[model samples]
Target: MDENGFWAMIEAAWGVAGGKAKPRQRLSEGKLSEGRAYALQEVLEEEVVPALLERLDALSADELLEFDRILERKLYDIDRADIQERTDGSDDGFLYCRGFIVGMGRAYYEAVRANPDRAITDAECEQMCYLSWHLYHDKFGEMTPSGISRETCSNPAGWPPDSKPDAAPDAAG
Candidate 1:
């Protein structure tokens, strides 16, 4: 739930990715190692490899919204100048971070659906659905009820099915 937790997860994922044991460090105790800062340059296309699995298991399933909030900040509040400086304007970091946040929401929905014992509030589910659609549309260049249906259904078996259409919708509505 803090930057140390975030950096630790980042370090662990990279360590695993490179075929080494995850570097488990107490990031809360001090600054992140400058060593891993170098790897950020090598991240494919500069995309921040989101530590999704790390976050999922680190916190209880019911606290997914907290995860969502973290992603929200990372995606929305990311300093453009900082990312540009870090990755030389590749845009990979920006795209990846945004997608990663949305991805976490999607993962949470699927994970919770598969195991309902750690259920989120209905409002949280709806927020996840909205966030999913918003991000999907942002990346995919189109938004439709069908797109939302794929993700935000009571059950995955036959979701977003022929539900009643809203009276009207506008581009910004």
Candidate 2:
């Protein structure tokens, strides 16, 4: 997907999922409210990240690094302390939660920055994607149930003896 398509997916998901920094116990709005975590599974990776990776892979090494900078420093910049303070109730859990998914990308971006020529592996990409599951959800607290296990979930996208994901194309290989 192109950047527009990718961003549109996010907009649509947020629209379906209510676009707020926080999510409701169940999505009272949107056609997809019926499925639990439907937005999470569908909107995030099945749709967005792959498209984003496509775009990321097509860029020059300098462009890739710049994209990462803009994403972390500007787009996904959430103050951890701010989220922590809002932990008083479920209504606010999403505020803290969204960061998890963003972090996955951020983690990979940081890795790439460390070595611009090293590609992030497909496996590492998946591990980075899974970071969303660990980020938020106390507020949902059984309200919107899911099968994801924080402990069992592994982000081995960049793993083993040499710890980094495969390159995006311009990075290497």
Global CA lDDT of candidate 2, please? Answer: 0.32
Global local distance difference test of model 1: 0.32
lDDT of each: 0.32, 0.32
Q: Local error of candidate 2 at 132, Å?
A: 16
Candidate 1 lands at a TM-score of 0.31
Which candidate has the highest TM-score of all?
2
lDDT of 1 by residue, 3-40 (tens): 44544544455454552222112111123343442332
lDDT tens digits, residues 7-54, model 2? Answer: 343344445444443432122222223243334534544555554444
The segments of candidate 1 whose C-alpha lies over 4 angstroms from its true place after superposition are 19-51, 79-94, 97-173
TM-score of each: 0.31, 0.33
Clashes of 1: 0
Instruction: In model 1, state the lDDT of residue 95.
Output: 36
Clashes per candidate (backbone, < 3 Å): 0, 12
